[model samples]
Target: MTDATANTAPAGAGQGSLLIKDSRTAKRNGAEGRFKMYGLIAVCIGIAMLILLLTSILTSGLSAFWQTTIQIEVTLPEEKLDKSGVRDPEVMAKVTTFGYAPLLRDGLEATIAANGIETELSAKDAAELISDESVAQLRNRVLRNPDLIGQTVSVEVMASGRIDGFYKGRVTYASAERDTNISPAQLQLAEALEDKGLLNTSFNWLFLTAPDASDTRPEAAGLGVAILGSLYMMLIVLVLALPIGVAASVYLEEFAPQNRWTDLVEVNISNLAAVPSIVFGILGLAIFINFAGLPQSAPIVGGLVLTLMTLPTIIIATRAALKSVPPSIRDAALGLGASRMQSVFHHVLPLAMPGILTGTILGLAQALGETAPLLLIGMVAFVREYPEAPWEGGLFDPATALPVQVFNWTQRSDPAFVERASGAIIVLLVFLLLMNLTAIFLRRRFERRW
Candidate 1:
């Protein structure tokens, strides 16, 4: 019986050994490993998608930053221009773009003839090599310097959009065959002109500094107005939203009593953060536009709408930042004879400030890219004229935002407009990048370890 008991005890001890792996434990470990791998794959996928998006944006938009321009020595015949012996501004203004077209065509012809660029294109088709805005551009130049109208002056004029696209690889020789806008002969002529230094590509500063152009003048299009409008809206939002958001958050988190009313307000604020941005657009349209009678397409209205959308986000972030502060901080301040208000303001608010600023800037970045709210407020209109200076009714003037401009450009039939749209996106992304960097810098600068 002792031998039999000894054998059973040895078998029981072997069965209870910790070295043996349990089936369930092995399965759980395998599952955890697979989950980690999945998370890693997700992160890699996200990074790949970001890289692809950036690559596409840069590829499609980089061409918009440079332009093809032709150098021509134009002999503005005295007979055609300033026909009235009096070099009067009003008389010059009466000479329409048509009156200037012949001089531009003649200049291009002379440049081609002198540079030995032989082409089958007639004087009419040669005129096609220049942008539709070239006449107006020349007119404006002459208007700015009236004495130069009759003088032989060297001027740089923008090449046609198709010619610009050709150099940028958007228009190929074969594609130009079917395109009525440009022919292969024209492309060859352009190449010859390039070789002789009559035509060249250079950085297009006008695109960044000038205003939007009409559909017929894509080469002259620019983002300056849109950028200015967005800047104005952001200024309005920063002025109105930051102070109001911080004050509301401070009151609710630190001072407000925990009651049903407060609870309801908190719940509503949370809900608002999740609401669709377009709903705020509708609310703005109804209240600000319809009720208050504010000007449609004004930056002020857009700012107010975005301020509402940003408020809840700011509140949520500020509260979370406040809540992250340790209770010990409050107690220590109180123990030091600080009042409740003083304790919160002097101790808690400072600690939470980094998060508040980060969140507020992030919220503003989000607002900067928003199109829906601005769309409903009539900011989608074709705004050719720039907004007046701030003192001269700029806020109330008709102006378009960057996102709305992008939307408008995409709707156009011209492929050059698409490039313009992409370029605008690059600019918008740059602004967002700067804002986010500022947030990160501020966070690190003010972050507290305790």
Candidate 2:
């Protein structure tokens, strides 16, 4: 009996076998612990990088929201603006921006004199402190209100980009000395105007409302045209891509036969999803513009291109969402004598709505930030006028997109335009974040688990 028990007993099981961990167990535990440590380090590194990116973006771009302006009272002598004294808008409009330029120069000189501020700079040099857009703006204002002729009205004119940059720390006195567009004397005069409360920095509504200015007038440049163009294209994409993509997805996922042709189509759709966005741009340029004779730089053309690019994304996501719906629900609906179509439409689709909407919005967001395709479609053109309303042929009108605007600004020689480019990035980021949040909200509000 003792020998039988000894033979049955395991070797080396007496002292440390049960209480002490084996070498293999300890090695696995050590490996797992190291993996956890590595994952933690990776997460920390990602957070630090994100903080650095946000900090840099906010610091450089926030200043673009504030504009340096010089407020001055100008006496619009009737002889200069409307010699007929008829208060005719047509007659007032006859005086071009060049004709209005002298009045602004005189206005600045008079404001200095009235403020009791003394400066050695000539009247022309002081006028140089104002933006090139000021002349055009004043002209438009006078034309809009012809009665202002022969009356003294207060006008707030934008400071030149150099003068603006000085206050925003983009330019210094030393830098102004080297800049051809500005001088140290001009900056000193700007300082005097500030001391007297004539020059000030305030929220620039124009940055949000006004159109893009020329290379010489960065302070007058705004995101208005770009914003509107993006809105119009988004509307187009949503109107077109959502229905087409979802229908195609439904037909493929629920109704199509599992045949070689369907399999080939499926593979091609996946391939299209992986295709470079610029290829779509080239396709748009060839098909929409070159062959179809559609207007170049039109939002309509851009929307079509983006729609083609976005359809694949929406289709893929919709198919995935549809597949996530449990097969049991469909089986139950069929067991109740419902048609296959009815089962999918009534039971399967409702369950998939949240993901469908999320995918559609995310696809739209991706299309919004797309630059290469838009560039190929000629959306990079400098567009000064707002597109007409949709009913008034607006979508076909020449326009610029936000990403295209950013690209345009970065190509300019002015540092102020660079700042504007950064600001545009911030705006773009906000738009993306809002879109992602909307996706989350819709997912939570409508998503159901079966």
Candidate 3:
């Protein structure tokens, strides 16, 4: 029996082999480990780049949120503002911005004199410390509050762009010495006024709340109009893009026949997604503005153009999301005595809703940051006035979008617009972040495991 067992066990049965790995297997494992290390390094580099971008944006843009203001006491001589002595607003409305300019200049001079902030600047040069828009601002204030016309009112007005840049560290003393816009003595006066509690750097809520000022009044410039314009365009895009995109996606994914025509349509849709945004801009300019006669620079036109641009993206995302749903869900719904339409709508559509909404919002966010198309549609035009209420004439009113506004500001000669553009970018990023976060939340909220 022992001889039979030895023969059956075959040759070398008593010899044992070591459990060491094969050389090829070891090399493969080492290669895998190195690949993982490379991947980790790549991820770390991406994270570092993201951090650097955010840090640069925040540091450069945060200064726009704080503005240097010169607090002045203006004695509104009755002879100048309230000659009628009736304290009537209608009478005050007749006083043009020119009529109000001397008062602001006198106020700045008096403030400097009262604070003993002596400088080499003359009375005119001292007044130049304040924004040119201050005249209009003061006139509007008096028109709004006629009783203030006869009173010595203390007002905090925005400093000129150059003066504000002095406090923001953008304009150094040496730079001011060479700049034709402002003198170094003005900076000295500003410093003294700051010490006297008259000049200050405060949180500028006006950056969010006020409208854009003239090219020369960058300190008083704000994103309010641009924000509203973007909001309006988003509303229009959301309303138009979601329904149309989803409908097209649904038909193409589930209902449409598989044929050459359908294949051609699908290929076109895919190509549209990759098309340059500037091409969409040109299309919008030609089709919407020229042919359709829609008002240029209006949110309605911008929204329509964006809707066209965003449709391909939304359709692609929605179709991919629909395809992700298991065929078993549809079969089960149909087997349970449901029609094809009911099966798709009740079971498949609900499951795909999260992805649909996510994709739509992401598309909208993309549209919100678009500038080229808007520029072609004339949204790059300067817009200082706020649009009417949405239901009234807001959609048709000429407006400037946030990205276009940033572009416009960057093109200006004023250094302060640099800060404004950066600040606008921060605002745009916040919006994009919020939209992306919402997309994430929606995806997680309704995602199904089956």
Q: Pick the candidate with the highest lDDT.
A: 2
TM-scores of all predicted structures: 0.91, 0.95, 0.93
Report, for every candidate in turn, its global Cα lDDT versus the true structure: 0.89, 0.91, 0.89
- Candidate 1 lDDT over residue span 322-372, tens digit each: 999999999999999999999998999999999999999999999999999
* Candidate 2 whole-model C-alpha lDDT, 0 to 1: 0.91
Clashing pairs in 2: none
Candidate 1 error regions (>4 Å): 1-25, 77-91
- Which window of 10 residues has the lowest lDDT sum in candidate 2? 1-10
Superposition error at 165 for model 2 (Å): 0.2
Instruction: Report how far off residue 338 is in candidate 2 (Å).
Output: 1.9
Q: After superposition, how far is residue 341 of candidate 2 from its true place, in Å?
A: 2.1
User: How big is the positional error of residue 98 in model 1, measured in Å on the Cα after superposition?
Assistant: 3.0
- Please give the distance, in angstroms, between residue 14's alpha carbon in candidate 2 and its true position after superposition: 12
Query: Candidate 1 or 2, higher TM-score?
Result: 2
Measured on C-alpha atoms, candidate 3 has an lDDT of 0.89
Off by over 4 Å in 3: 1-19
Give me candidate 2's TM-score against the actual structure.
Answer: 0.95
On TM-score, the leading prediction is 2
